[model samples]
Each structure stands twice: as C-alpha cells, then as structure tokens.
Target chain A: MAEESAARKDDDIRILAFLCNWCSYAGADLAGVSRLQYPAKVLDVRVMCTGTISPYFVIKAFQEGMDGVLIAGCHIGDCHYLKGNYMTAKRFQVLRETLKFLGLEEGRLRLEWVSAAEGEKYAEVIRSFTEEIEKLGPSPLRKKKAEVGA
Target chain B: MSDLKSLIKEKLNDGADAFLCLKEEEGTLLPALITDADSPDLELAAVGEARYPLGKILIDLLREYPDKRFAVLVRGCDERALIELSKLEQVDLDRLVMVGVACTEEEARACGCPRPYPSEVALGEKVEAAPGRETIAEVESLSDAERLRWWKEEFSRCIKCYGCRNICPMCFCKDCALENPHLVEPGVIPPEFPSFHVIRALDMAGRCIDCGLCEEACPADIPLRSLYRRMQEIMEEKLGYRAGESAEEKSPLSFLGSEQDIKKLERE
Candidate 1:
C-alpha cells in the first residue's frame, strides 16, 4: 500500500508537451541519442507545425490531469513551413495570458524554441520545466477518485 | 410618441422591408420583427434593460429573406456585433440599415458598458457609462494563491449552463470548443477550472465585442466580461489587433505573419 501511494504521487506530476516536427522533435531525438538525461514526466505529441497546437489541446491537457504543458517550435524565420512559427508565437502569447487570467500559474505553460542541433538546450529545458511544475504540485483541475465517482 | 417610433415609421416608408426592435406587450419585452408600418408595432418599440442576441437573430432573417432589405434598432454593442458579423460574411451589410439607439444613463451604468451609443443615434441622448473595474480590481488585489482560491470558489458555482455562449452575438461557430467533449469533459458541474472559461476566453481573444451580455447571462456571475476584456487587451498588446474595429482589418490570428510582425511582438 505504501509503495502504491508513492507510485500514485509520482504519476500525479505529468506534463503534456507539443513539439513541432521539423525542429523541436529533432532536437528531442538528438537529446536521446546524446544520452542527455531528462525527466520522464513529459509526454510529447508531435505536430507538423506548432501553429497546429490549438488552445483547446492545452486546455484539454490540464482537464485530463497534466500538471504542466510545454510547446516547442522552430525559431522565427526557421520554420520549415515559412511563417508557421509566427502564428505559433502569436497564439502562444494569447493562450498564456488567457490561462493566467483563469488563475493558472504562469510557470505551468511554457514556450521555447530549439533548433535540431541544440540537443543540450532541449534536455535543459525539460529538466528545469519539470522542477518548476514539481514545485507548483499537481494541477488544480486534477480530479480526485471520490469526486469523480460522486 | 417616442422618437424611435417616428424613426421606424420613416424607415418603413423609405423602402425598408422590415424593422427589428423590442416590443412591450402585456408587460413582457420581446423582440418584434415588424413589416407593416401601419401594424401599430411601432407604438410598442421600446429601449430598456432587456438585452437580446439581436445580431444572431438578424443572421437568420437576412439569410431566409435574401432579397428583402431590413432596418434594425442597434445599441453600441449591437452595432459592433453586427459589424463583426458582416466581416465574417454572416450578414450582408448592403441590404441592412441600422437605426441606432443610445442607452440611457441609468441603463448604461447598470450594464457597465463603455460607449453606450452607436455611431448614428436615431433616438435618446448619449450618456457616459460608468467605467467598471471592480471585478478586475478584486481579483488583482489578491496574491496568486488567493486569486486561484477565489476563482476556484467562483467557478464552483457554475451550473455549466451555456448561457454565456448562447447569448453571445459573436459565437456563430457550428462546432464550438466549449461543447466539445474532448475539450470540456461531459457530466461535470462547475467545469474543471480554467478549461471551460479558458477555452471561451481564448476563443473570444480576437472576437469578443464586449457586449456584457455574457456576464449578464451567467447565473454564476463569474465576471466573464473582465476575462474577455483582458483577452482583448492582450490581443492588442501582443498582436496589435482589436476585434469589431474595422471591416477591412482581419484579426491577426486569422493568418500567418512576417518576421517584422513577430519582431515587434517580441519587443512588446
């Protein structure tokens, strides 16, 4: 029983990450190849472009028990599809503010740019983001078993 | 003998196929779509506290009767709603006329609406609406933890009634994120905080005209207008776009941008 509760506490600190396929996904792959150790709490979803990551997906992540979310895209002017990252930039700005207004911690949602060659930076970001969410604890939206059954 | 009736009658005589206005019948104020100028409907045309999704209603009338031109009694917020609708091709502006009505001082204060008069005031004198920031101030006055606690408490009261979305003039989507089971989970009273309201706020970012109807419709009194108002401010600050301002200016979110736009946004 004690072991099960310890495992449950570890499971509570989940993060959902959306990585743009062209750059951030490659960077993450490079991090794995280089044996750069990062927290396993982040679960990644790869999309053609960061612009494709709608605010609904972010909201849904929190609703489904994600403690934090990270969106990584190509640097501006580096998008595989020209100008796709620009849309990502604008949407991310608005999404962060909207989430902030609703009382979500500012550190819970993050956006970063990682080139394919920047494997170390990708690992570093994941490490730091995991620590931040750890300090914040489980998401407020995280449903309890009693509440769900009720 | 209100100025609104004479204006409605004039429009009817001058080739308007129909006029849409509020009518007080047996102590109930309802939306009255009038065609005949002699039908005595103009006598009951009223301006009052009752707010309706008039722009949403006009979309049906205009599409159903494509050939007929109509006039609508519009308030400041209603005008903005209609203007945004026209941009989306939801309503044809060429076949419609606006008989604008300015809100009374008391009514404006009660609604906490800024700019209480339409561009062309066909009736009533324009009065200044009392500026409202009490809700924003109350939330801002708290620490992050307290603010979160306050929002959690406030959101717990939500019955998950879609009154805010239903009455909004700008919400014309056939597939709404708020209704999506994938986005907002089904069978939950007081929907998971920041999901339901956050989705609506994100959707309203570059679209909400700030009609204040959402706050009025919310049985929870969740200070929805303030949330959307902050969205509008962030939209302007980040993307330099304001919804319902111009028919020609597309929302910045509607399309991709150049490096210059992104650089300026970053600097801000």
Candidate 2:
C-alpha cells in the first residue's frame, strides 16, 4: 500500500492540448519568449486548423488516460483558414455533450480562443485550466481495476 | 392479400432473378427467395409474422453474385437498413428493386415504430399510425441515478454473441472496438457493461437508421433499440442530421464542420 501511494504521488497529470498553429501555438511560443512560467504537465500538438481535430482523437486521449484535454483556436471569424474554426465549434459541442451522457465530467475537456498577440491570455488560460484539472485530480479512468484489485 | 400476390407475380413476370419475401411454411414465416413466378407457394406473403435480417442476407447474396440484380420486399425498417447499407457500400441500391410493404397498425404499435412504411410503396396503403417511442420514454423518464442503474441492469445481460453488432445494418466495419481485447477484455461475460455498450452507442451516433434489428437479434433481450434511438435523437437535435435521409448528407462526426457548426454547441 505504501509503494502504491508513493507511485500515485509520482504520477503527474497528463494533458493533451491541440493548438491551431497560426494563433494559439504562436501565443504559446510568445509566452516562453516573455519568460512567463506555466506547468509542464501539458503536452501540445500544433495543427494547421482546429477543425482538423476529430472527436475520435479526444476520445482516444481519454481512453488512453489523459487527465484533461484543451482545445485552443482563433476566435470565430478570425480563423486563419477562413471558415475552419466553424467545424471545430460544431464538433466539440456534440462531443462534449456526448461525453457527459457517457458519465464523464464536462470539465475534463476545455476549449479556448487565443490570438497570436495575446500571450498573456494564453498563459492565463493554461494556468486556470491546469489548476481546475488539478483540483479534479487524476482521471478515474487512469487507475486500472487490477491495480486496486477491484 | 391477393393483390399483393399478383403484384409479386407481375413483378417477377419480367424475368428478373428472384423475388425475396416471407413465406408461411408449416405455420412459421421465414424469408424465402422465389424464382418461379408461376408457383402457387408465392401466395404466402404474410404481413406480420416474421422479419428476417433481409438487408444482411441481400448483401451476402449480392456479394456472392455481383452481376445479379434482385428484388426485395421492404417494410419501413427494412428500407432504412437498406439505405444505411447502401451508404456503407455494402449493397448496390441501383442494381436492386425495392417492393415496399406498409406494416399494419398493430405491427407498427408492437415495434413502437414511427414510420411503419417505406418512402415509396409498391403495395399496401399509407395509413397513419401513431409513433410509439415507449422504450425511449421509459428510459428518459428516469432520474440520472435511476437511469444509470437501469442501463447497468439491462447491459449486464449482454452475452457478447455479437448478434446486436452482426444484425445492425449500420455496423459494417472491417475492424470493431468491441472485439478489441485492449478496449473490451475477451473473456468478460457482460463485456465491461457501460463501456462496451456506450462505445457502441457513440459509434452509432449518426449511422443507425433505427431499424430495431439489433434489439431483435439480442438473445439476452436487452433494450438496445432504446439506447440507439436516444442517440439518434441527440444527433438530430445537435447537428440537424438524420441517417438514411439522403445519400449526399455526410455524417457530421465523419467530416470537418464549419465555425457556424461549432457555435451551436458553445456556451453563450
């Protein structure tokens, strides 16, 4: 039991964040250049457009033990690819609701809009999201039934 | 009744391959492929006795003999199944002729079906039957805890026969997550209850045409249709998409939607 608790303490939360390359990714890079510090728990994947992010990817992340997922894109009409963010908005709406119906907490997934100029907003979003998830603790799905002998 | 017999005879008289319909043999009605148009056995087109997984059987035969064009008897459920199968590229819709038969009021009531008749009818009158969604209503009326408990109880009886998956016209996949050992452990009887069933429900989001075949095929008598019907409602409400409505409308989950699409689900 002591060994299990020690291992649990060492276990860091795994967050999967999908950032649109044109805006949110640039904002993330700017935060680094500005010497702004944030938690390293997040692993970022930059995509050409947030529209390309499938709900299947999000579901796969959860199934694989991702404690939280963040989707950051350009504000509505401000999409670099014109109407690309439209699809992202529609997909996540259904995805979030569907996840709730499946008995998952809606807070586990978060979506935000950050512009290239808003490095501070990007940092703030990440900080708040990470804190929110930390309070929620590790995803219940992460613990295996066999590990707890359930 | 005789009019249906003559309709089948006239349709078959053109010398197409075979006419597939239910035949009453020794008080049991089952699907039979009749080739001889002149045979008196064609008189047994029982309306409500049995419903074979005609779409699946048709797909199998069509695959075996690629060059043949066959005529099939379709009720509302069968038409939906055929439409779904066509989308999956399992059945060639162009090469087949659909002989639509409208279901009786009692039949429609028993199945709790809304559209108890196909879109285009070659036989039977288009009568208005009250859509019965009792299964969904029953589940929807429960509290969250009760709903969860109800589903847990219902799903606990799953034998993993794959009957629900096999009979589903929309479930035409080369690989399935339900069969994956990593996602669903092989030896588990109820197959991890909510996970297995929920995964399937999620997959059926925009694809299931509400054929009710999955529920019919379950040996355990799980109310699989209710779960899928709820999903169908959700898909329609969220995306304004309904399966089997048109071949051109792609499933929202399968495509990259617009920013307008995203706004519909976001908080104001």
Candidate 3:
C-alpha cells in the first residue's frame, strides 16, 4: 500500500499560473526561445494585468483541484500600465492573509515579480515554485474516487 | 409622548389605510398591521424595549397582497432594510408611505447605531449616537493567531439553524452559499468552522445594513453583527461604497465600474 501511494504521488502536479501580459507572459515566451528547461506541469493564463486577478479566481482554482496557484506580475513601480502592480500587491496581501485565516496552507499560493527582460528569472521562479508544490503533495481539495461516491 | 400619539392619530385619520408597527401581544412585542384608522390600538405605537423586524413582516404581507399599499414606521435600520429590499425588487418603495421614527438616546447607545433615525422624522427626538469603534479596535488589537482562534471559537457554537440568514432583511437570494453543500458541508454542526461564517461575511460585503437582526436571532449568541459590520467598513474603505446609502450607486462587486476600479485592482 505504501509503495502504491508513493507511485501515485510521482504523477505530474497540476499547477495554474496567472501571467501578466506585459511582464510574466513575455518572460515565459522569452524562456521558451532561450530553451531554458523547466517542468511542463504549469497551465498559464495571460491577463492584461496581474491586478486583474481576483481572489475569487484563486479560490476557484483550488476548488477545481489545481495542486498550486502562481501569480506572476510586473515588479512594483515597473508596471507597463503604471501602478498596476500596486493593486496586485495589495489584493494578494489581503487575499493571502484571508486564506491563511481559513486554515488553508499558505504555501500553495505564491506571488512573484518577473519583468519582461528577466526570462531566466521567470524560468527559475517557475522551477522553484513547482518543486515546492511537488514536495507539498496534492491539494487537499482534490476529490478522491471513493469520496466522490464513484 | 402624547403629542407623538396625536400626530400618529392625525396621520392615520388623513386616509392612511393601515400603519405597520410593533404591538405588545401577551407581553411579547410582534409586528402588527393595524387597518382601522380610528382603532385605539394606535396606542401600541409607543416606543418600547422589544424590537421587531418590520421590513421582514412587510415583505410577507406585500407578497400576500400585491395590490395593497401600506404605511410603515421606519427607524434607521428599518429604513436601510427597506432601501435594500427595494433594490432586491422585494418591495415597492413608491407604494409604501414611510413614517420615520427617531431612536431614543438609550436605544441608540445600545445599538451603537450611527444613523439612529431615518431620512424624514415623524416622531422621537434626534440625538447623535457616538459610533462605537470598540469592537473593531478589539479585533484589530489581536495578533493573527489570536484573531483566528477568536473567530474559530465564536463560529464553533453556530447551530447551523440559519436563523441569521433567514432573519437578515438584505438576504433575499433564492440560492445561498451557506446552504450550498459544495462550499459548506451539510448536516455539520457549527458548520465546518470558518467556511460558513467567512462565506456569510463575504456575501454581506455590500448588502448588510447593520440591522443587528442576525445577531439578535442567533440562538448561540454569536457576534455575527460585528463580523458583518467590519466587512461593511472594509467595503467603504476600499471602494467608498456604503450599502443602502443611495439607490443610484450600484454595489462594487455587482458591476465593474469605470477604468479606475479595474485599474485599482491591478495596482494592488
């Protein structure tokens, strides 16, 4: 039983990452051109700004059984739209605090600053985040076959 | 006091079909609909210790008879409820005549109500009630761990009777998050800790009118009002919006207003 459970844990982790169109998405595109090797576990959604991400989206991601959520945005004061990152910063601060208050493991969600010029930084951030989430195991929110009455 | 009584009598005599207010029945105060203009039961309009949710009762009565027009005595909280109900399309505000009553100093103090009276005054003396900031102060003083523990303890006693939701004048939704088994597991006493209460607080962001009826109806004596009141403060601070303050202003979450609101989210 232990060996079987260990084998199950080896499967790829499902991660949902929100990339800002001006910074994170561009950095990810650059990483692909640079051929920087990283795990392909991430599913990315590109939004006009990281500030566009609602806390509801994060909650919904978990509810949908994503193992982790990554929110990558422009560096503070370096936003393409001038101060967009400021709103993202404040919202994530409150959302992270609120999620922690609800007894959810705060490590499952991460916020990082990735500039359009920093393709290597984006790749490194993704690699580290994926490793951390893989070590943390699958999200408790995932529905088990028996739990679903299947 | 008799002057106020005569004023109510005069209003009733002036073709007011019925007045909605509280009447002491068997030593317990309940909302009563008095139809006869000359009925001596107008004596029941006297301000007393017991409080009834006039808005809730009006919804039931208005639903039962759609064509009838009724006049109701409105306090600050009652007026707020009426405003929200009008927004929810539960009540026809134009059809109802409002006879506003100001709260007494003692009553104001008990409620810590900022606007203890309605828009137009028909009775009682207007006195400014100092808004009590103590509840917020107490919660803010606690560390994150302490705050979490405090809320968990308070929420642990929730009977899941949904008296709070049922009694809320603003809660008119046919589907409720608290009732949803996916978000909140059903048949669980105290309701899986924070999910039930947190969902309620989130939902109350732009709707709660600070009526205090939820806390009043709670069988476990939970401080549900303080939680919702804090959420109201957060909405006003973050979005500059207050529920029931104006019919023209839409809720912050209901619609994405302008580029500023969307931009503000990005800046954070």
| Chain B TM-score for the candidates in order | 0.94, 0.87, 0.90
Residue-level lDDT tens digits of model 1 in A1-150: 557444666346888989999999999999999999999888899999998888888888887778999999898999999888898889989988767766778999999999899999999999999999999998877777676563
Clashes per prediction? Answer: 0, 8, 9
Pick the lDDT winner.
Answer: 1
DockQ by candidate, in order: 0.67, 0.31, 0.13
Q: Write candidate 2's Cα lDDT for A32-136 as tens digits.
A: 899898887898999999988866677767766788999999988899988787777766766766666544667889989998988999899889999988887
Model 3 over residues B129-210: C-alpha lDDT tens digits? 8877776678767765567677778888888999999888887778987777777778878676556776677778778899
Off by over 4 Å in 3: A1-150, B1-16, B38-43
Q: In model 2, which runs have C-alpha deviations exceeding 4 angstroms?
A: A1-6, A10-14, A18-30, A40-57, A63-67, A73-88, A113-119, A134-150, B1-3, B26-28, B38-48, B63-67, B122-127, B131-150, B254-268
How well does candidate 3 score on lDDT at residue A83? 68
Consecutive 10-residue window with the lowest summed lDDT within model 2 chain B: B259-268
Q: What would the per-residue lDDT of candidate 2 be over residues B234-260, giving only the tens digit for each residue?
A: 888888888877866777876666655
Assess candidate 2 and give its lDDT.
Answer: 0.78
Clashing pairs in 2: A86-B258, A86-B259, A87-B257, A87-B258, A87-B259, A89-B262, A90-B261, A90-B262
List, residue by residue over B172-227, the lDDT tens digit for candidate 1. 98998888887787897878876887888888988998889999999888888988
TM-score of the candidate numbered 1?
A: 0.93
**What is the full ranking by TM-score, best candidate first?**
1, 2, 3
Q: Write the per-residue lDDT of candidate 3 for residues A1-150, one digit (tens) a residue.
A: 557444655355889999999999999999999999888889999999997886667766775668899999888767888867666665565456455544456788999989888899989998999899989777765656574454
Candidate 3 Cα lDDT to native: 0.77
